[model samples]
Structures are given as structure tokens and as C-alpha cells.
Target: MALASLAAASLPTAAAAVRSRVSLLRRAMAASPSSSSCAGLAGSPARVGVVQMTSVGDLDANYATCSRLTKEAASAGVKFLCFPEVFSFIGSKDGESIKIAEPLDGPIMQRYRSLAKESSMWLSLGGFQEKGPDDSHQYNTHVLIDDSGEIRSSYRKIHLFDVDVPGNMVYKESRFTTAGDTVVAVDSPFGRLGLTVCYDLRFPELYQCLRFKHQAQVLLVPSAFTKVTGEAHWEILLCARAIETQCYVIAAAQAGKHNEKRESYGDSIIIDPWGTVIARLPDRLSTGFAVADIDLSKVEAVRTKMPISEHRKFDSDWKTS
Candidate 1:
């Protein structure tokens, strides 16, 4: 069966597991707003910001770019701000990523945490090179920090980019990056956010689990996609996920050339549950952010009208025991 079709098919065990897990998450993250609580804000809209960046080998320079963007978003009254993958540093040479990998409690993350508190805004540090279990490998981790400078939740990118595109580029991310095993979702004032990195966008099953099982209303895809692939499939794939999950999708992207060998396709976008592009960066490779109002009522309205989750059927052959 096609992966897209498989995503629509029922996965009873996965659904149950996510339900049980999110229940525990609610108790743990007491600061997180509930869906019922967010209903009260239907009269008002929460503003979100997505940043498109061109991160290079200089760590300080990359941090400076992020800092500037954060200030801009905060000044604009953005409640939640998301940065692209490798927002901190995209190395110019091989093996540089692992050399600079740091733990969640390290100085690099501490600075970001402080930035969130100082700006008085929730931040999704879309992707960071996190120190993994082994010395030689790192995890491409996505971190969520609340306005109060607290770590809300983090998800390591599960799907690595290990493809040799016909004639464009050859990326073997798995060579130095350790794959994460778990799926993660978190609740916020905006809505429940389903966290995912670049390559994960290609897998719709993850989005399905987040929407149907974890009850995610917004999906985050932070990527540093190559120019070749982004031109062909980036927006198409992102819109498909939003349509399939019936959820809002926010994609923060890295744009322009990172180094001599690395270049990205930058088109940061905010999409509604109906697959409409609400906001996007005008200049593809410019370091900037696009802001949009995230209305949870829209999510509720769409799902209510369609009610596909309740109507999906399972093939008898694949039904769980």
C-alpha cells in the first residue's frame, strides 16, 4: 500500500499509546493550556511568527541573526516564534556538527532559554545539534521553550535525510546523527503542537498519529531543505500534511547558501487547516520572519465540518488483535 494510504488506515495500538501518553503529558506540563481553555480565546487570535534564516559556520553570527529576529517578532506582539532548522549553526566543513554538539543544559541552549524569557514569548528553537548518547554522534533536536524560560518539551528528529538525489545533492545525515525513537507532541496557548523536523514532512503517518491520536491542532516543520528539492516538493509536501491532518502547519526554513557546498531553498510559510497559505516570506533567501494569527476556532470548525477522524475505516487484514 502507498505510505499515504497507510497513514489514513487505522493504527489501533498507536492511537491508544498516544492517547495514554498525552494524558500523562497534560499532568506533567501543568502550564500547558487545554483545548477547552483555549476555546475561551476564540474571540481573540494568538499571533505566531515563523523565521527564515541563512545560518552558516559562525555560531555567534547565527545566534545574532536569531536574536535580532526574536526581538523583531516580540516587538510585533508575536506570542509564539519558531526558527528554522540549524538556526544556531550550520557548519562549513565536514565533522564540524558533531564537534559542536551540546547537551540540552549546555551554554548554547541556556542562551536560547534566556532569549525566550527576555523576549516574553514562547519559542520553538526548531532544530539544534544536541549531544547524543555517544561521543561521535549527535541528535537533530527540536526544542520548545515557554515564555517563562522553562523547557516545555523536545523531540529528536527521527527520520534522517539519507538520500542521493539524482544529480543535485547527496546527504547522509545518519552517518553522524543518531535517530530518535519516540514521537512527541506538546500543548500550548495556541494549540497542541505536533513537532517534526525536515525529512519527517515526507511521512504522513507521523502527522496522522499527531492529529487523530495526540490531538494536535498545529504542525511544525522546521527545515533546511536543499534548493533542488525545495523547489520541487517543499510547499507541496507541507500543504499535503496540513490537508491530511486537518491542522495548521507552520514551516520555518533556512534560505540561501550556507557555505560553499550547502545551499537551502527558503520559503517560510504559515498554512491554515484548510491548506491555505496565510503568510509567507517575500524574499526567499532573506533572513526574516512572517507573522500570522493562529485561531484555534478555525481548527475546530474544519474538523467539525469534516469529521473524517470518526469516519476512517480499517482494513480487516491489518486490524490489531
Candidate 2:
């Protein structure tokens, strides 16, 4: 089947790329709005919260942490909540993720839907391993649930993390997962949101398309950054994306040590267009959350001042070899 046909037929169930399920949910909601239960949350300034999880191989433990943190964020008047990558379970080894992969209509997604509805908040799951038919592949997916508990928008991690970082940090996402070909963004009360996952951060062009083409005012980057790179590049890169694009960036990260001898740098943050960190979690346990208010006016103000979008000069000599 063609890639579009395959994607249309079923939710992208490729485990390595995060946010595929959310992308699927977005398409579904767009196709049939009545099927979704969540209502749109509207306002110029959006109160956003993020959940950071130091997920282990245990599903129960991860779910409990998400539930608790979500409740806390809701109590704090957070209307939009985002979670870290692999919020359900981060396995100890490769292939171990397949064991925990569930279908889109399974218990895991259902739980998230219920949570969004009960809290009366728009929710975004960073990424999950969703089981596909025949169980051959699992999608690394993100999902957005509206305040009314209806699924809103979703995106698969288009840029697979298939590179070899020095010091033995090697990831071959294409080995077990499929790549997403399309970029996705969604409209909400907060503004247009560009959805992406961990590895996608390295590609600035994707953000350019999202910002310039889709008019995305906010970008959501849910990550499980490794210690080696996160310490050096995580914050800086995130800030740069926000500054360059003049958009709000919300990055909910996985922190602390996991059972597989892997340590994640946990510094989940919300950055404004001016590249200011509004909220962050102090280093501690592997699980927690942060909340911040996003003002769309700031995005407009920055864009108006810089006007980078309007001033574009392309040299004929510019070429890619």
C-alpha cells in the first residue's frame, strides 16, 4: 500500500518515532469532529502544564506518576498539559518496547482520554509505543486530547533518531519503526501548535516549515534526552528554536536514571519567544511536572519586531551538494 494509504488506514504504529498516535488522532478528529468528545479550549493566553517522567520498564509505576502529576497540574489551573516521551514505559533494552505496545483504542489511550475529560484540560501525550495489526511494528506517537476529552491532533516523529553519537550513543529507529513523511500542526485556543519529537530537534528546516508554512506560534517538543547530549545541547537548542522562530517552546523531558543503566537529563521547561525559561522542574526524582502561562501576544510582538518571515533573500548560488 502507498504510505498515505497505509497511514490513513491505521494509526502509524511505529514504536521508535514518537507522536504517531497523536498524529493519527488528529486526522480522525478532523475527519469526524463529532466522534471526538473533547471541546476546544479558547483564550489568548493559554495556561500550559507539562509532565516529566523518568519512566522505567514498569507500566503501573509510570501510569501512577502520570495520573498524580496530571491531577496536580489541573489543580493549578493548567488548561493544556503535555507529557514526556515514552510516558508509559521506557524499557531496559532494545526490542523490549514491543512488549508494552498497545493499540490506539486500548487501555492506555483510553486512560489518557478519560484523564483529559475529567480534568477538563487539553492534554498531549509526549509519545507512546502503539501496537499495530500483526504486531510487526509499533509507532512512537504523540496525542492531543481536547478539554472535552475528545482526541484533537496527533503527529508521528518524522525525523527518526537514527544516528551514532560518540561514546556509544547509537540509535537506529528505522530498524524497528517506520518514518513519517508529513509535518503536522493543529489549531487551538492557544494558537497553531507544531508537533514534533526528540530527534526532530536537529532539523531546523522542519521548524521553519511549521512556523512559516503552518503559522505555528507554539512548538511542542517532548523528549527523553540522554545525559551526555542533554547536558550540553538540550536547553540551548530548545532556546534557539524558540528565539529563531519567535515561538513558544514547551519541552517536557524525561529525567533521572532508568533501570537499563540509562540516565536522562531532566530539565523540562517552557520558553517564551524571547527565549526565557518560565517554568522548570528542579533535578530530583525521575518524575514530576511544570506549568506556565503562554501569551500569544508575545509571539506577535516578537514577529513584528524581527519580521524574519517577511525578509527573505535567496541567493542563486546557494546550492546543496
TM-score, candidate number 1: 0.87
The per-prediction tally of clashing pairs is 0, 26
Deviation (Å) of 238 in candidate 2: 0.4
**Model 1, 90-169: lDDT tens per residue?**
99877898999999999999999999999999999877999988988999999999999899999998777777765566
**Model 2 stretches astray by more than 4 angstroms:** 1-44, 132-134, 284-286, 314-321
What tens-digit string does per-residue lDDT give for candidate 2 at 86-188? 8888888878887778877789888889888888888888778877444556777878788888878777777766655556456677676666556777888
Best by lDDT, which number?
1
lDDT of 2: 0.74
User: lDDT of all predictions, in order shown?
Assistant: 0.82, 0.74
Error of 1 at 69 (Å): 0.6
What TM-score, to 2 decimals, does candidate 2 have?
A: 0.83
